[model samples]
Structure formats: C-alpha cells, structure tokens
Target: MADYSQSPLELLLANQQKGYVGIHVEQGVPVLDRDLNLLQDLISATVRAVISRYVGNGAAAGANGFAVQALPTGQNGQDFLIAAGDAGGPGSALVGGVEVVIPAAVTYRSQPGLPALTAPTAAQPDPRTDTVYLDVSLAEVDGTVDAELNNSRDVGVQTSVRLKPVWVVRVSEGDAVPAPPSGHSFYPLASLLRPRGVATLEAAMIGDLRQRRLTVSDMERRMSLMERTLLLPAFTAPAPGQPQFVPKSGVIGQPITLNGSNFAVAPVTVRFGDLPAKIVGGASSTQVVARVPGGLTPGGVSAAVRITVSNLGGAVISDDTFTADPAPAFAEPTTQFSPGNGTPGTQVTLNGFNFNAAGTQVRFAAVAATVVGVPTATRMVVQVPAGLVPAGSTNADVKITVTNPAGSIVSDDPFRAELNIPAPTFATTPPQFFPKSGVAGQQPIILNGNNFNFAPVTVKFETFTAVIIGTPSATQISVRVPAGMTPPGTTKDLKLSVTTAGGTATSTDIFTING
Candidate 1:
C-alpha cells in the first residue's frame, strides 16, 4: 500500500538521506539543483512539448522560408530532399527542454560522395517512394564551447549535439532509411517525388519516439511527469514576498523551481511574462514549483520576462527575471478539402502533409467534427457537424481548422457544407388521428410530419413522456398516448408535441383527452 496523502512529485523524489522538502531552507539543509532537474525532467517527458516549430506547414504562405514545399524530381536535374532554392532560415522546435533544431534546409544531394536518392528503373518502375522525416536522438559532445565560455579547458559538455539537430535523407536504392533513435521527437516533412517516387513511406509519427508504443518502463517514467502536471499544489498562507524562479531560463510548460521568503497565502497566482503558469505541488515559504508560461523570447543573455506572484498578502514582482523562449509550434497543414459541400454524417476528405491523429483535431467553425477512420499525414476524413448551422436553416460556410501540439491552421477558404435539417412538423393542423376512439393505451396515435425519420423521434402529451409504437418514417410515426391518463376523464385542451434531438414543436391544435 502507498500513502495517498503525500504529493506525487514529492513522494517520487523522496529518499532515506534527504529530509522532506516542504521548504529547503527550513530543513537547514542545502538545496540540491539535481532534485530540481529531476522533477523538471519528469514534467517535461510527460508530453511532446513543442517550444517552437521551425517548419511551417505548406499551407501557411509568405514570409518564413523553411515552410514545407513540393519537391518533384521530374523538374530537377539531381535528387534533393526539398526544393532547390532559398533553403529557408533555421527551423527549430523546443520539445520539452531539448531544442529540435533544423538549421538551413538540406536542398541538394549533388555534392559528390553525399547521399543520393534512387530513381525508378525502366525494368521496375512501379513508382518507388522516398519519404523525408525528421529524426531526433541524444548526441554526446565534448567541452569545446564550455571551455570557450569558461576560459578554461577543464569544463565538461555532455550532450552538445542535443541542441544541434542534423538533417538526413536516403539514397532510395543505395542507402538505408534514416530512423530516429528511440526517446525523442520524430516528425515527417514530405516524401520526395522520385523518378521513381518517394521511398519508404512513413507515417507522420510525431511526439516522443519511446512512447510510440508504451512498455512497462515507459509507463513508469511517463506517469511521473503526467502526475506532476495533473496535480496542482495548494498555496501557502502567511504570504511570502514576490517569489523568484531559480535557473532563470526554461521553455514553455517546463517545471520551474521558485525560492522566496514568506510565501504564505491561500490562493496564489504566478505569471511568466504575461502568460499564467500552472502551480504544481511542493509549495512553501522558501520554495514553490511552477510550470513556465509561453510568450516572449530571451531579451538579454538569459532573462526573458518578469514574473509576478499575486496572493491575498498582495502582489509583488520578482527582482530576478525569468527567461522563457516564445516560439510558435509547427503550423498545421490543412490546405484544401474536396466536395466542399456536405450534410451531417457526410465524410469529407481533406488534403495536407503530416498529421498526428493522436494530437490532431478538426473543427467546423466553433463546432468540433468527428475525425473518423484512419488518417494519413497527407489526407484525412471528418464528418460534417450536425450543428454546422442553426436548425431548419439550409447551409453555411464552415472554415475547417486543424490543431496539433505544434499549432493550428485553417483552410485557405471557407468550405460550404450543408445542414439540411428540417424541423419535425405536422403536414396538417390538428393532423389526422388514427382510430379516433379507442383505449388510451390500446390504440396508437399516428402523427404525420416531414423529416420524422431524419432523426430519432419522440412524442409528448402535456407534461408526460409518451412512448413510441414503432419505427418512424419520413412522414409519419405512431406513438402511444400516456397510459396514465384516466379513462374518458375529459382531460381538456392538452398540448400535443413532437420532439427530436434538435427541438420540440407543439401543435397549434389542442387535444381534449379521454380514454
């Protein structure tokens, strides 16, 4: 059995030698930076946090270079991973704390001895495919930069390549496909249009590589980080002066450690720049842990923004600045959708490059649509939302938007989809009554209406819920009058109504009821 009382992050970090860290200062023990790093790492690994996405979806036009483009070999003399000209600026994404950087696009493979893409031969020209994917892995580095910064040659640099991402491709026939090492980010960009066609078609697999398929060890590690994010730490009372975050720099959603005196208050609010940071457990007068907020790049060497901690004790800003890099996540690729018009339940096809089904969402205006079946990086299908327009109104222009961890993007133009939703109504006033005189529960009442079968139907008598007799048709439905009505009791002027999922319609004529 485990103790449910202790904070999840605290319990995981606890050990025999170190005392509980409600407040590091109060324990008279020195605070360990390693503890902070461990807590932060676990928080970071819970999800594929995108600090910034360097490459824009092909649909997002203008300005930024590195945005995905069509690379057709039929138009080029030599094989290349992307278009030949203007390899757009550096493309970077902050995944958790690791910077998945893409510096200067890898344009041509013509540099003799460099990798080459294989073309489909006349003997076997079945359209071989070659795909371009972003692979991320942990890389080790020596202390060259560290020595330069410290003016000494003795310093250490464990993972220098961690920040410097490599651009790799395949020779289609000669070289093996480049695979991203497990435990990091791997995103698909586009497939080369081989003479040939693209080789080794890959899914738009985004997020943590280790978690593509979870195992026991993977679950344990991920659970720790997820717990920290899900659990919010309660505020300390007595109110501490403005609290400052330790390690002045961090990426968005990364756990940050705060230290201050008199951090005693019931409800506390902390902000990184202008964005609000979430409060996790381990809060005390001397220290509190918080997740970093988005917006604002590093203005100076490290400081990016001012942090303000507000509580009942009053608000105060930290003297020390907290550095946070504000990079936009990848632009979602939602370019065009076909058969523009559709009704509820109609499956509409969408075209784009690279989509993560787990992280992707589709919406028609403000209403979300169901993303059904399997979706490829380049295409997907979604059902038109029933609420595309107000009930009874025919059609509307719904702008389809796609969102993922990187960011959100809308179609270039509005998609005109139909919502031919006609409300249920009687064809005639005081519509035809079946078997005018029969026992209340014995004889059924047949209500004639339009669109009765368009949706599920139900009937109501006054304040009672009536039961339906059988299946409803496009123009009619048979329902039993409320059995509770006393026989021939002369129940006068009862309002009879027909109801569907959309709304209810009361009849202009009233029913004077008798069994």
Candidate 2:
C-alpha cells in the first residue's frame, strides 16, 4: 500500500497488450492509502481507462505515455499524466515531448473541490500489459452520502460495487482499443450485440422532487380574518319645505314665482342668493310667492332655496344663484311742463333703459302715469299723469313704476325723475293801476291781487305824471303816486300785474288820477 497522505506518488499505466480495462477492488481499502503499496497503481489504472475512452487507444502509439499520480492534497489535489516521448505517437502530447507532462499550470486552473492535474514525471514503461494491480477499501468513496445512492444494498452485508463504474474495449495483445459507451446505461451494450434487433429499452423518469411547501387552506384562513369587525348602518332625519320665487330679467314691478322640489315635508326656506325669498303664504311646501322686492342690481340675479333636512343637520339643498330685479329699466317720470306750485296735473315724460312697449303703465309717485310711446322691452316713454311734487328748492323725486310681463323691480334705483316745484302762482284780485289818481305826494293808490309772499313789491312812474307798480301782490299793494305826474292830464288807464312764485297775473286797465 502506498502512503498517499504522507508524500506524493506518480503511477503510469499503458496499454502494451489488447485487453479490456475493469475495476477490481475489495472491502476496507483506503482511497489515499499510502501504507497500501499498490494504491497509486489502482488510481492510475482508473484514470487511464477514462482517458482511453475519451481519446483513441492507438492515438498515443509512439514514445508517448499516459498515467495518473497522487499528490499530497484533497479531492481538489492535482493528479494527472499524458503520454510523450517514443511511448506516445507523434504530436500526441499536449506540448512537445515524449514523456507525458501533467503541467503544474493544469493543477492551478482546476476548480476548487474538484480534482486537478500536476507536472509531468520522467519517462516510464507501460503497466497495462504487465497487469499493474492496486489495493482499495470502503473508504475510497468518502463524502458520498447514502441519499445519493441510486439503489440500496443488503443491510450490513458489505456489498461490492465499482466505486467508479468503467471499462475499455481491447484489440490485440500488448495494445488496447478505445471503445467507450456514448451514455451511462448498460442496456446499450445488449443491443450492440445484435445489430438489427437493437431496441431502446431505457427510459428516464421525472417528478416534482422539490419539497411540498405551502398549502391553499393556510392562505384562505388569513384572508378571511382581515377587517373582521362589523359596522352599523347610518341614517338621516327629514326636514320641512318652503316656497320658491324667481324674478324676471329687465322688468319693473313684476312679481317672482316660487316653486319647491325635494322638500319631502312642508317648511322649506327660499333665498334669493343671500337675501331671504319672502314667502307670502303660511303653508309649508306650498306655493308661497312674493313680489321681487325693491332695490336690486340691474344685471342677472339668482334665487336659492335651501331645505332644512333636520334640526341637527342644516340645509341639505339650497339654490345659491337667482335674479332679483326691483326697479324699472325706464327713467322715472320727467316733468314736461312746470305746473304752478299749488296746482296738480303737470305733464312730464318718464324716460329710462327698457321702455319700448306701448301702453305700459307708468306710476308717478304712486300715481299711474299716462302712456305716450309704445313701451318696448328696452325703453318706456310716458307722460307724468296728473301729480305734483311738494314745493322746495331741491328736486322733487317722482316715483314712476312700470307694469309689464317681464318680471318686476329689475333695478331699485333706475334714474332721477326730476319734478321741479314751480314757484307760487299769483293773480290780481282787482284789475286796476291808479297812477297819479291819488293826490301828488298825499294819498297813495292801492293795488290788489292774490298769491303774494316774501319778495319785494315795487311801483314805477311813467313820465312826470304817469306811475306804474313794478312788483304787485294779488290782493294788496300800495303804490304812492309820483309828485311829478299832474292829476289832470296823467289820468290814463294802465294794466297792473302781480308777481308770485306761480307767475305774474295781469288785470284789465283801471284808471285812477288825482281828480
């Protein structure tokens, strides 16, 4: 037995004769048995068989040699040889030499944990023809677990099977032929014996060898428990109903209509945007309509209705946009002719924006105005029906309301309808101007009229004998005769007039001289 663990050993096996190579071994033989004198020879024989199967037997027929060696290492230890010199055929060696060289380079390049080759040794004789036998033991196949075994042997019987199953075909004595099986099955050999009767009896079985991991029931249980909590149902209370009203665009004094929907019960609130849509009726959810109140912008406005769904819950539904038109498009009544301050029935035209149609009723300061031009949708021309604004220095406001189909109160303030209060009207009570009728510088002639207030009253003198009153009151005015007017010839008839806020009133000629 060779002490393989202590030092390295190189073995050479050659096919000097034609014979089949086979594995021959016994129980308890150490794979690296250095004490066993013939261990190196056994491993060399195994390697030669493998190489001859791959390459042809006669391929190394010259001075070349092929063999195996055992180095002081593990399964990854270097162990290899090749035929060279006259022992191997020409160009048969991996490099140039008759002696086979298992170079050190080959050993270093081998993968870890896998066997490798080493440097070549001196030339050696062939061992195959001489029957180079080696020893073996059960330990030769160490690290190979029972699980890796394809079949089980009889319990504790110590069965003998080839540690490495292999064989090589032969030719003649002193030389071996290389004929290896294409695959690792014994059936192919049986078929090769009978050429035409060859049949493929071997079949490979496949299965799910992997572990049976997770089951379906486990996943289902996890999914069912997710969000296991129960939830209660939700509810809401009902609310009362209200009326709805919408204003017409660009029309004055037109009432708005109120309609309600989804007000399940009665009390509903109707709002014109922010302002409350006044409900005239007391009934809930009933049609309670009101006029579009005065004072609204001219442009488009919207009405909103919000229903009280519940006491705790505020408005569930509400209309946010609606038109609120209050004033007429046309201007207020304008005074055409100035009537005396005391008199009524003054003529004036009411002018403004949408006053196109005819017969459109115009109200002047609460009094309905008389129509003139057809009040179109745009402009309304009308006369200020008999009315009077109170007397004052400031302009009197004439409220002229128009009536048409296009909703009412389009604008709160349309424009200024000015009605100037005429100054008081005056008339002479007695038609007479006595100029020089009174004694010169002695008696003063008196004039009478009506409507006389705070303004200065003046009398005029015509020539040296004639005299006239410049400003006179309707019932009372005393004008002193000028001393220059002789009563005799200046007793001529003259017209007298009274000046008042209403106007000047004249009387027929009344003569008075210093007779």
Candidate 3:
C-alpha cells in the first residue's frame, strides 16, 4: 500500500519535499529486534555513507558523531528521526554547521569564592544545571527543495564506538607510609653527622670550639667596623689606560685616584681582587690617589680600595674595569656639596684623572648654589638645595650639566614623593599662653594644636606695639619671655597671638604671668 514503485532515496526526498524532516521508515510494524543493535548499525552506516558521499572524501573519516538514532514511539511500533546537521551536497561538499539541542534538569558541582585554584574548598552543588544532549545527522540533497535528511550509517553497519578517558586510582591504608629505597636512610642527618663525631650535642661543642679559635674582642671590633663600612652609591673608582692617565715614570710611583663625593676617607689600600695593587697616602672624599704598582699585567682588571676613617668604620668601594696602559694621566675635581634630596646639606667631590679644563658653573633651577673648587672641564663641584622642592613630582636640573657630567643634562624622572604641603593654617586650643604669677621666662607655658603638616613653620608672635617669638612649627608653640620685660608686681597681663601663611589667629586676652 505504500509507494514501493520509487527507490528509497526518492521516497525520502519526496517526504522531505513535503517539509517532513523525518518519515516513517517502518510504519505500524513491531520491531522484533528490540536489542537495538541492528537498528543502530543501520542508522550509523546510512549517516556515514551519506556524509562521506557529500563531503567527497570517500568516507566520513573526519566527521565526528555523524549518526542518526531511533526515538521511542507511543504505539507498539518504534519511531525515529534525525537531529540537526548539515547535508553535504554538490554545492556544499562539507557536512558542516550541524548542531543538536536537548535540555534536562540536573545537578552539578560548582566552584565559587576560592582564594586560589590550588587549594579549593568544595561548595554545595546546584541541582538546576542545564543538561543539553546533541546528536549529529547526515545531510543530502532534494532536487528543488534544497536539502534532505537521512539516517547516517557506517559502511560495515556496525554500532559506533565511544572512547572515554579513564583515571587510574590507587588506594592504601591511611597510616601507611612508603619506605625510602636504597642509600637513603630513614634519618638522613643523624646517619651522616654522627660518624663524624657530630651528634646534636657534639656538633654544638664543635661549633663552640671553632668559634673560640678567634679572640672575642678582635672579632667583635673587626665585625663592628665591617658592619659600619657599607658602600654609598656615589663612590666609583677610575680604571687604568683610560682618559686622565698620568705618566707613571714621573709619578708612576704616585697614587691612583679614587674620585667620588661624600666618601669615607682614611688610611686606604688599593688592590685587585685579593691582591694588593699599591700603597700611597693622602685620602679625602674628593681624592684618594694612590700610585699604581709596577709590574702589572696589561689586560682588563677589577680593583677595589678599603679606607678606614678615624673613629668611623672602614669603607670598601670598587673600581670600574679598565685597561692598564703603561702611560697614565691623572685629573681630579674638587668635591662640592650644598644640599639636596631633602638631605639637609649636599657635598660634591672630584677624584682620579684629568684634573683641569674650563667653563663650569653650578645651577639649580631659580636658585644658585656655590661652587666648591675652580670649575674645570674634567672636574666641577657644586652644591644642592637646602629646602625641598614642592611635594609631588619635582624636576631637578643641574647647572653646569656638561663639564665632567656624572649624570644626564636633562635629568628625567628626578624625584617623586608625597608631601602634605598644607596651605599653612594656624591652629591652637586655648590659643593664649602666659607664665605663672611673678614668673619671668617661667615654666609650663605652652600652646597646643594640630595640622603641623610636618613642616617647619615660623610662628610670629606680636602685640600691636612689638613683635614676639612664637614656636617655629605647625603643631605647638612655646616661647620664653625675653630676659627684659618689666612686669607689674609678680604677675603681668600680656596679649597672645599666632600667625601663619593662611592668616593670623589672635586670642584677645591679657594673660597674667609670673614676672
């Protein structure tokens, strides 16, 4: 009764033309093979063949999950349908753009609010995880309808096999510990040290003996000196055979220079590695020139000098690498220092080689700092600022940026800091102060307030007639009456006031003070 006159493909296409994605392959007939093995094989083979033919690849080698599956029917017979997939045809040779969707309600384990992935605590599983099932179907062509669907199948008509990753697990008793193999002993330290007469207490005794080999006072002094002798950044020595080399024959026995500012100068020794280079005297932060030892090899070299200052600790700073040219020139600039980096004061130094030239002056922004020595092309020393540049990023441009420039002319990224540079507000509680009755320049006269902003602010004390001296900072002020102030009786009334950049604050009170 069904149209047996057409081929199966024609019938399938005819049904597809009617907009039917799936048609009854077997209608009203009970499938005795409930094992589903034969049905699965048939579906798989059909899908694989169709996909392969359309893809022009001779087989569905690259296709993944290319298959069709049977669905359960309401009647005694079974029903089946294809899922979402691309039908490869002449125009579209690739069976691509296939997707299947199924939704289910299930529970899943999730992770949340973990500090780190390495150590994660288990969270409660949510039962509302979405479960979507996807199945693939093969695609074919219908004459004018554009596309047709078919159940995919394998060539051999075999059920498709699935591969799952498996994890191998090992189980053991909770307290079971694995034994160390071969030469490794259960107690490694005891086995190694005991035979050498170094058991715990014995080892402590050996340590004590080794320690006692040196006199405590000598060790302590040496260590104390060594500890105090840390190298500051400004010290760098000169190399041989470089510029500023003096003729050794004339002053060959003369000292090589140690050029730097803010250096610790004392008795010094110049050396290469552990080997002493030479010994010559007269050391200062500006110059530590020692004669280069004769009979030195000609090659790259690293040398250092250790200086022990009087009362202060010894300082050891290193020299840069240089070639040893038999000929040497010596030039050193004077150490000039003023103040900078909020350092209260600044100092500069010139040491080692090429001592003289011309055209030098030290400039710092709108401020002028004094030069220490005669300005020379090789050596120019200048001072820095005493007051700090305003807080925030500040640019410090040096005057005489050229002559023997240790740093760049346009100094970039010079300084940055956070400063609470207040607009200078004056504050005080009980803003008036006076000494006890009859007390002159007496005790316990103080003004207290806040917002000092860590700056040294001068407080000008004044009465309408003459100016007075208040304390010199933002937070608090205390002043002693000048030695000459005639008091009325033992106590006298005086006016008190405070002034700042922001404005002046006055307490209109006559205070009684001990004269």
- Best-fitting candidate, scored by TM-score: 1
Question: Which candidate, 1 or 3, has the higher TM-score?
Answer: 1
Whichever of 2 and 3 has more TM-score, that candidate is: 2
Report the number of the highest-lDDT candidate.
Answer: 1
Model 1 spans with C-alpha error above 4 angstroms: 1-252, 258-279, 283-288, 294-303, 306-323, 327-422, 429-431, 453-458, 461-465, 482-495, 507-515
**lDDT of model 3 at residue 89?**
22
Clashes of each: 17, 107, 46
Better-scoring candidate (lDDT), 1 or 3: 1
1-515: candidate 2 lDDT, tens digit per residue: 21234432222123213342333456786553433423444454556545434432222222222222222333322222211234233222211111122222222223245323222222322211211111111223322444323244435432322233322211121222223232211100000111122121111110111111112443453355443211111112223333233332323334455444333233444443334444455523323344333334433232223322211112443332344333345433332222312123344444453344333456656766566545444444455444334443233444446664443332244323434323433233333534424556644566544544424333444434324344444455665555655445555544445444444555565444453
Query: How many clashes (backbone atoms < 3 Å, residues ≥3 apart in a chain or on different chains) does model 2 have?
Result: 107
- Evaluate residue 184 in candidate 1 and report its C-alpha lDDT on the 0 to 100 scale: 45
TM-score against truth, every candidate? 0.29, 0.26, 0.19
Per-prediction CA RMSD (Å): 28.9, 41.5, 29.5
Q: Would you list the rank order by TM-score, best first?
A: 1, 2, 3
Over 278-361, each residue of candidate 1 has an lDDT whose tens digit, in order, gives: 898845776767887533432211336777776544566776777654322122234477767878888888775444334678
lDDT of each: 0.54, 0.35, 0.33
